[model samples]
Target chain A: MPQCSNCQFQNMPGTTHCGRCGASLLLATALIDVHPPRATRWSKTWRKSRFWHIWHSLNHLSADLARRVDVSYPSSWPSILAAVRLIVPGWPQLAGSKVNLGRFLLGGYLSCGLLAAVCYGTTIGSFFIAVAITIHSIGLYDVAQSSSKVRAVRISRILLGCGLIGLFLYLPLFNLVPQYAAPFAIRVNREPLRVGDVLLSNRNAYVWARPRVGDIVLYELNPVRVPAFEQGRNAVLNLAGQRVDRVLAVPGQSIVCDGRTLTVDGQPSPHRPLNLTFSSLQVSLIVPPDHYFIIPSGERIDGLLPNNENIVRTLSLIPITQIEGRVYWRNYPWSRMGRIR
Target chain B: MARFRKLELGKGLPGDSNPDGPSGNEQAGCLELAVEQRRCGNYENALRLYSRALEDDKSLVTGWLGQVQMLIMLDESVEAELWSRKALELFPGNGDLLAGRAQAFRRMGDKGQALLLSDGALKSAGQSAYRWMVRGELMIVIGQETHLHCFDKAVQIDQDWLVPLEIALIYRDLGAPSRALGRIRRTVELAPDRYYAWFVQGQVERDLGLEAAAIKSWRHCLELCHGHVDAERELAQLEAGGWSVGRVWRRLFGNR
Candidate 1:
C-alpha cells in the first residue's frame, strides 16, 4: 500500500489516487517502504560485505579472514587473487570497467591511520597501538614490494607514515598517557556535552584516594538494591552500565535538597538547585557506612531517578562497591575540551 | 473506514503563511522527500533535505516547520528557537511558527513565555491539529488542568492517529497508564499497522506490570517495523529475566 504524500493516508496498492484525499499517489511510491527489514538473508550478506569493506579499507586482516573461506576453497584461487589485486589497484586503462579501489584504499588508510594516531595520543592507548602497529606493518610491506611502486615514492610514503606513527607513540613512551580513558563515549548524547565531545574517566584515580564532594564519578547501578516496584516499572534502572554523576556527600554527612536549595551538613552547597518539574523529592539521611550520595548533572533530575521509593532510597546513597571510576576530562570537541571540574 | 480522516494539514496554524500553494518544481519534490525522511526518523538526512528545500523556496512554511520540529527532537532548543524566530520574521503572525517558538521556550524552562506564546498561537491556530497538539503539550508542561481538552480539540479537528498517540503519551507521563492504554488502543484500532502505536501500547502495558502483554505488544511492534530500537531494547530487557533480589544483594555488597 502507498501512503498519500500530501495527507499521509495509507492507500490501497495500485490506487491512482489517495482514498481519503484526492491527491495523485504516483509520488507516494517512495514513502511506502520507509524501513525495510534487515533480518532477510540478503540484508545479512549486505551488512557483512559492508563490514568487510571497512576492514579492507583499513588494510586489516579481518577483511582477509572474512574472504579466506571463499578464497581458499575456490577452484579459481589464482584468478581470484589476481582479481583482488587488480580491483584494488585498477589500471587507468580499465578505469570505466573497474572500481577505483586504489583511491579508496589510499584514502581509507590515511584517514584510519590519522584516527588511530589521534585515539592513541588522547586516551585509547592500547587499541590504537595495535592499530598503529598493524598499519605500519602494511606500510612496510608496501615499501618492500617491488611491483607496487617506485622506490622513491614508497620511501617517502613510509617516512610520512612513520613520522605520524612516531608522534602518536611518543606520548605513551614518555609516561605521558592521558590521565583518563573514554571507554564510554556517548556522554555527548546528553546535556553539558556537545556533539563530538568525549568523556574520559580514570578507573584507578579514586582507588587510592577518597572521592570527595563535587567530584564527578562513574558508578554502577545495582538493580537488586533498587526496590522491586522500580525494577518492575522501568527495567533500565537496574541495567548494568557506568553512569556519571557528581558526588554530593560522603559517609556521616547529612544532606537536603529542597528542590530550590541544597544544603550539606548545615552549610548551603554551591551547585545549581534541582528543577521542581516533578514532585519535589526530599531526603535527609546520615550517609551510611560505605555509601556515597551522588546526583546526576542536570537541572531536572526527576526522570533520571527511579520512581519507587526503595529504589530512590538505594540510589540516594550509592554503595562504594558500585563506584567504578572518576570522570576527569572532556577529551573531544577540541574547541571546548579541557579538564572537567 | 473511519481510519481515513479529512486532513487540512499544513494550513491550520498561523493562518497558512504560504499563500502560494507551492512552486511545484524540484523544490516541492525535495520538500516532499524531506517530510518523508522526517516521518521515518531519519533526522540528519531530513535536515539536509529540508535545508535544500528552503534554499530553493524560502517561503515554504512546512520546510521551516520541519526544521524547527527536528531541532526540538534533537534537544537543541536554542537552535530550535533561533530557527522559529527566523521563520516568524518571514511569516509574521504565523500560528505554526508561534507554536513552535512556544515549544522551544517550554523546553528552555521558561513556562511563562511559553504559555503566553502558546495562547497567542491558539488565537491564530484556527483548526490546525498540529498547533492544538503543541498547545496541549505546553499546557501539560505548565501543569494546567485543561491539557486534555486541548488534546481532545486536536483530535476533533482531524481524526489522525497521531493526535491520539500524542494524548496517550501525555497520559503515560502523568502516571496514568490506564488512560494511556485506553487511548493507545483506539490509536491501534485506527492504524493497526502503525509501529509507534503498538510501541506506546507496550510501554503503557509495561508500566501496568503486564509483562506478558507488554512483550506481546512489543513483538508485534517489531513485526510491523523490524529493528525498531525501543521495541528491541524492551524485548531484550524482558528476555534478560529482569533483576533478582539475590543478584542485587551481590552487586550492592560485592567490592570492585
Candidate 2:
C-alpha cells in the first residue's frame, strides 16, 4: 500500500493520487541532511592547540568516569552543574531546574546582601548578613538533595559538602563583619553609655581617616594602680582595659581644663567628658604630632590617686595606634537605641 | 434438560493430549512465546517469558539477550546494563550481547560508552541488523553524516519490516523527524498489515507538521487494530485542535 505524503490516505501501490485528499502518492521523500559542516583550516588548527588538547582530555576523562558510575538519572548532570554554581545562592537551584525556588532564593539573597551593605555598621546589617548566609546554605542543601542518585544521601558526603561551604563562607566573613561593626557592652555607668547598654563600634573607622575632635573613641589604656576603699581597707586596683572617651584636641593643639571649664588653644571647647569631674584645678597639655588629647570617661583618675600627675599624663595622651575604633551606635535597651553622639 | 458428560480417569478428555506434565522443549517454547510477546510490544510479558526461559536453561544466550533488550525497551536501562554485564561474563565477546549492552548504554545517556561498545560489537563477528542499527544510533547521537548509510546497511542485512521500523523509532527519539519519515515510509510499504507501523507513521507525520496526513495514518492504524488506546488518544487530540499552550511549552522546553 502506498500512503500519500501530504494527506497520508492509503491507496493502491500503483496509484497516482490519493482517494480522499487528492494529493500525489508518488512524491519524493525530502531528505533533510543534518550533517555538520567539515572543519575549516582555523578550526583544524585550533583543535591541535594545547588548550584544546587539555580540554579534550578532560572531556574524555569525565565521560569515562560517568560511564563507570552509570550516572543516568534525569537530574544527574543538572545537579552536578548546580553544585559547581553554589557560589551564588539560588544559582544551583536555577541550574538544577528548580526555577521558581531559585528565583525566590536569588532575589532574597541579593536583597539581603544589598541591605547588609547599605546598613554596614548597624545591628540590622549583621542580621541581614546572617540571613543571606542561611539562604545560600539552604540553596546548597537543596541542590545536593536533588542531585543525589540514592534516596538517602550518604552522611559523609553531606557532612563534607557542608563543611567545605561553611569554611568558604566563614573565612572571609569572620574577618569582614568585625572590621565593619563589632558589638561592645558597657560595664560601668557612664552618662550616655550606661551599664547594660550594648553599642556597636566601627573597627575600620580610622583605617583611612584620622580621629577628629568631638568623636567618641575606644582606646586601650596602660595599667594604673589606684587606691580603692574596698571592705574599709585601702587596696590597690589595677585598671588596664579598654575605655571610651571624647577627643577634645587633635594633633598640634593645646587644651586647658580648670575643674569644669575647658579651653582648646585659647578658645572654649564644647566637647566634655561624659560624667567626669576633674580633681586637678589646672590641667593643661599640648597634643603631639601623632597623638590626641582625650578625656577618659568615668571617675577622674586624679580623684583616685594620692599622686595623680603620672596617671593623668598616662591617660591624657592617646597614641594613634592604641585607638581601637569609634563608638557609632547603641543597639540594646530599645528605648535608647540610636546613633552615639 | 442438559445432561453432564462423565469424566475419564487415566485417559483424559478429548482435547487433553499431553499425558506427561513437562516436556524437554519447554525452554524453547518459552523463548518462542517471548519473541511473540515482544513482536506484540508486550515488553513486560516478554521479559517475564525470557526470565522463565533463562531459569530453565541458564546458558541460553538468546534468552539473556531478549531479557536485556526488553529491559531497555521498558526504560529500565540501569537493570539492563547490569544484566548485560552479567551475560557478557557468561558469554564473553558475543557480538549480539555487546550490541544489546550498547543500546542499554545509549538509553542511559552514556553515548561515549555506547559508541565504544558499538564499535566493539561491529569488530567482534557475525554482521547482524542489530549491530548496524546500534552503529546508526551512535552516528545519529554524534551528528555524523554516515548515519543514513548505517541504517541502510542494517536494512540490507535483514529485510524484516521490524528493522526499518526500529530505525525510524530511533530517528524519531533523537529528534530527526525528517529522517524518521523516510524509514517509516519504507516500514509501512514493507508491512502494511502491522498496525503499529501505521501508528508510528501517524506519529512521524504529526511530528513533521502534516496534521491531515497524521489523521489519515492514525485512522488506518485504528482500522487495522481496532480500539487501540494510543491511536485513539492521538486522533482525539488532533481532532480537538492539537498543540495546547502547555503542550507547546512542554514540547519546547521540557527535558523529554
Q: Of the candidates shown, which would achieve the greatest lDDT relative to the real structure?
A: 2
Model 1, position A23, has a per-residue lDDT of 49
CAPRI verdict (incorrect, acceptable, medium, high) for model 2? incorrect
Which lDDT values do the candidates have, in the order given?
A: 0.63, 0.74
* DockQ of candidate 1 (2 decimals): 0.01
Model 1 bad stretches (over 4 Å): A1-341, B1-26, B37-48, B170-178, B241-256
**Candidate 1 residue pairs in clash (backbone atoms < 3 Å):** A224-B248, B14-B95
lDDT of 2 at A228: 71
Q: How well is candidate 2 docked (DockQ)?
A: 0.01
True contacts kept of 1: 0.00
Fnat for model 2 comes to 0.00
- Tens-place lDDT per residue, model 1, A1-341, is 87654456688899876676464655322222111111234533543466744643454343344457555565522232333333222221122211234344445555665676455334554565565455444533443343235776556645654564456554464344344463446533445654456677777777688888878777885543332335358433333355677787888988876655678898897743121133355666678888987654432345444355565566567888788788887656567667776
Q: Runs in model 2 with CA error above 4 Å?
A: A1-341, B1-37, B40-58, B67-83, B104-116, B139-149, B223-227, B242-256
lDDT tens digits, residue span B1-256, model 2: 1343454357422223444421447667777888877765677788877766665455566777888888777766655776787667556667788999999788666787888899899997568998999899889888898988999999999999889988988998889999999999999999898888899999999999887789789989999989989999998888667556755664579622
Tell me what fraction of the real C-alpha contacts between chains A and B each candidate also makes: 0.00, 0.00
